[model samples]
Target chain A: MQLDWFTVAAQIGNFLLLLWLLKRFLYRPILAAMAARQQRVAAALTEAQAKAAAAEALQHDYLARQQEQTASRETWLTQAREEVVAQRQIWLAQARTEAEEARGRWRTELQREQQEYRRTLQREAGQRLLALVRRALHDLANAELEAQMASALLARLHALDGETRQTLAQAARDGCAILTAFPLPEPQRRTLTDGLQQFLSPELNLDFRSDPTASFGITLTTPSQRLAWTLDSYLDGFAAELQALIPPAGGDNASAYDQA
Target chain B: MTISPDQTILFEFGFVRINATLVFTWLTMALLVGSARWTTRKLSATGELSPWQNLLEVLVEGVQNQIRDIARQDPGPFLPFIATLFLFIAICNLLAVVPGYEPPTGSLSTTTALALCVFFAVPFYGIRRHGWRGFLHLYLEPTPLMLPLNLIGELARTVALAVRLYGNVMSGGLVAAILLLVTPLVFPALMHALELLTGLIQAYIFAVLATVFIAAAATAQEQTANLSQSRR
Candidate 1:
């Protein structure tokens, strides 16, 4: 085979030209694109990692806040419970005091009412006894009873002590009045005047009067001295004695006392 | 019948001549360049890829991997030259099965041009990587007396590279032609099929040998430098 120098030169030149064309068109652009793709993948991975870290930090912060809120809620609950218990105790104590005061007032009022009721009963009983005695003595009153009362007066005058007799005798000398429930006989009146004069003075002046209100009794009234023997006087003394015998009704012993 | 496409001169202008080999070479170059341009016109970095772009990327990445495997280094510097040599030869040989289409690799001139490129590339890469002095000193390795032998080995390997590729492609075509004259149908078709396999193998061999020569020269001093550093 004959080797051609021109052909060799031309073929080499063609090969070189083909090489430049292939490198420019095929190799460079493909390599550049591949490198760009790799860079994009790397950048995306880095950004995703950063976002994940931020999310984790936020989760931790939320957990911490939740824990703090739970602690605060627990503290508030405990304080509220304690306050409620203390308030209940205070209310219970005040209620107890009010109940005790009410009981004491009720007892005092009851005692007052009972005392008023007893007083009313005593007064009614004493008025009834006095009325009975006044009625009995009114029924029994007569001329004979008056005569006996006059005699009793004389006897009582004679039975008087020296000091009492002297007061009566001195008062009788001033002006003596003789009151009788019944009309006395002339001889009895003369007799009463002589007896009183003997006890007082021989020249004693006396006035004899008939008083219808004097029931079965005689009274000798002087300016400064009085001597009476009547059923009303005896009845007044009996009522006073009966009132002293009965005791007062109520005291503080029955006040309210609660155990619970 | 002409044995080589180079003998058929389509034009003559005084001393200069244009032959079938030259014309077919231009056609092959235009096909490769045009296809590359079309494939790379719209490339996507992250999204879906076109079937053509996938094919082109596979071809490029395959070439780079081969170079890297043989050279035991980065394939960037040697990629363009080596890829061109392999693509041109492979395309030429693969088209040989077509009726009346003569592969440019069948021409001694085209094979010589490819070998010559490898020859020049060895020294160019070596000198660039390790300086002229260090590159020249590689011939004297093991002993100074082996310099002439080393020089002859370089020339012989380059000649061998050209002759081996030319002989394989030309002989395949010659066999298919002779079988067409003799058996006329079935045997010639079989020979054409066989030629396809042989042509692909020859192209692979050419590309691999070129990569070896270049990588050996480029990394020779680097290996020596590393060895000496370790020793120190």
Candidate 2:
């Protein structure tokens, strides 16, 4: 085939111009839009990931705070319980000490009262015994007949029991001198001395005197000693003798003693 | 000048032709122009068509499919250029059967023009996709020492494309002409059938080469942008 150089050159120029125009107007814009869309998608995905991480962190922090609160609450409850138990123990200890002290005080007061009552009973019994002894002495002085009977007792001294006579003789031999506040004749005194001398040692001295206060009883006085055999003494002796006498064993006698 | 079967005739000023070469060139040009106009005018949004519309659609669709394979991107914008090139070459190639018509593409002048356009457009699209800086840097690839070699290689590719098309088409013509001179009856029928096959094959080769050149330019621009981003 024959080639047309002019026609071919014109056609080549047309093709070049067409490619240039399409590249300029269409391809460049499409590629730019695609790149922009890619960038937007990448940025959006990064932002979403960051927000999700932040949310997860916040959730973790919240859970940690909740756990801490629970722990703190448990601690507070434990401390409160300890305080209450300690307080209760302190109160109980105090109460026990107070009760013990109260019991001790009551025991001491009861002991003191019992000791005071025992002392009062002992003093009252001593006073009653002293009063009864004084009354018995006054009653013996009023019995005069008994004193007169005892004044005649010197004449009947020779008729005394041998044990009684020997006791008097031993008393005379020990340099004892007898003094009397009653009157006696010389012959009678001599007879009395001679009768006493038969059972007495030679160391005896006898004397006589008259006194209305003697009350018909012979009284002997020795140096630093006195012996009186008076009606009051005889009556006291007779009362003691009567009190020592036991009645015959009978139901009536025993019943009478129980009544007295 | 006088025209005879064995004598060369001069027409339209100083143009010379031995036989029907001039008539074939005019017929090829007329067919290309006519088809371009009809295809553009009858393009349907819904794709419903008459026989002529169907023929035009198939040609355009075929070119688009080839471009799609090479570019690996939308071939819509490149369809007109690739389709026009394919149709022009196909018409020129088939015109050899029209008694006195010869395909102009069988000559060095026609193929050289097409190859130079491809050479220039390849860089032009590369510069448009990247920039003038990137287009210039394509020669400096592999290493700076490879710059001269790359330039020579690009020149060789353009020369090869042009020469290969010219040689294949011209050899077909030469064979047919020689055969016609020997046995005009049985040989012309066989030669006509061979020419039809050669016409389709040459047209496809031209379109595929153009598609490959455009694809290379696009790929180079993409690589440049990737390198720049990586450096940053």
Candidate 3:
């Protein structure tokens, strides 16, 4: 085999031309396309990562705001509940106070009304008793009853202690007077006068007077000392005894009265 | 018949002669350049590729990958030269099956021309990468005693690249022609099929060896530096 210098030279020239042609046509464009595609993919990945991070930040912010709002709502709810409870307590206390004041006023009014009613009842009962006594005295009073009353007076005088007797004797020296519900006969007057002379000083002088309002009783008066027994005195003593027997009304015990 | 297609002189004028090997090589170069021009006329950079563009991309990308794998370097500087070598040899050998068509690669002249291109390309890439002084210094690697041996090894490998491809392709054609005369039917067809496989493998080996030789020269300084660092 022989190497032909001319053919070798020509073939070498041809191979170099082909190399130039292929480089221009094939390698450059394909490599450029591949590089462009890789760049696009990398950029897309970076953009997606940025978007995802932003979305995560937004989610975190939303969650924090939601938690804050929830806390605020809880605070408002608790405050509202407390205010409602406080208002309820205040209203309850005010209602209780107004009710107590109303009850106290009602009790005072009731007590006043009760006292007025009791006074009215006592006045009516006293008037009725006095009327009955007056009617009995009108039917039964005579000269004999008068004379018996005179004897009762003398008995009361005789029952006095020694000091009372001295007081009456001294009062008789100051000038004595006799009062009668009715005018007496000469004999009765003289008996009264003689009874007084026996109990007092013999030199004492007395005047007799008549009082029409002193029903069924007699009274003796001196300038400094007096002694009398009258229907009015006995009726006053009877009313006082009745008042002591009945207890006083309690304050604001309307419900207690219901139990009673 | 002449043993070499280069001896088949188609024309002669004074000292200049034109032969079948030159004609066939020119025809192959025309086919390659014409097809490239046609395919690249309406290239689409960003959209769906036409079938021609797709085929071209596959070929170019495949060549780039092969070069990168062999060279262990960026395929950009070596891709076109290496790809052209493989395509020309493979196409020339593959077309041998055509009636009345002689493969230019069957000639020692074409194979030697390709090996000589690789031989020159190795020094070209080395000098470009590390300058002339650094490229000359690689022969004295490890010790200065290895200079002649390294120089012989470089020439020997280039010669081997040319002889090996020429021998395989020429023998396959010769065997097919002899088999056609002997048993014209199945044996020749079988030999032609075997030739197709062998032709492709030889083309691949040529291109890979070219890439390896060039890459070794280009990165020799770096390799030596790495070796020194590794020793340390």
lDDT of 1 at B81: 84
- Encode model 2's per-residue lDDT on A234-260: one tens digit a residue: 655654554345222233433533453
Poorest 10 consecutive residues of model 2 chain B by lDDT?
A: B1-10
Looking at model 3 chain A, report the run of 10 residues with the lowest lDDT sum.
A246-255
* Deviating ranges (above 4 Å) for candidate 3: A63-260, B1-16, B38-55, B98-100, B142-145, B225-232
lDDT of 1 by residue, A95-183 (tens): 99888978877786667677757776887777797898889888998767777777888998988999999988888888999888888
Model 2 gets an lDDT of: 0.62
**Model 3 residue A111 lDDT score:** 79
Q: Name the best candidate (by DockQ).
A: 1
Cα DockQ of the candidate 3 complex: 0.38
| Second chain alone, TM-score for each candidate | 0.95, 0.84, 0.95
Candidate 3 residue A188 C-alpha distance from true site, Å = 33
Instruction: Count clashes in each candidate, considering only residues at least 3 apart in sequence or on different chains.
Output: 0, 8, 0
lDDT of each residue in A91-170, candidate 3, tens digit only: 99999999998897778677766875776677677668867876677567655566666666777789989999899889
Error of 1 at A39 (Å): 2.4
Of 2 and 3, the candidate ranking higher by DockQ: 3
Q: Is the docking of candidate 1 incorrect, acceptable, medium or high quality?
A: medium
Interface RMSD, every prediction, one decimal place: 1.3, 9.3, 1.9
Per-prediction DockQ scores? 0.52, 0.06, 0.38
Worst 10 residues of 2 chain A by lDDT: A245-254
How does each model score on lDDT?
0.85, 0.62, 0.81
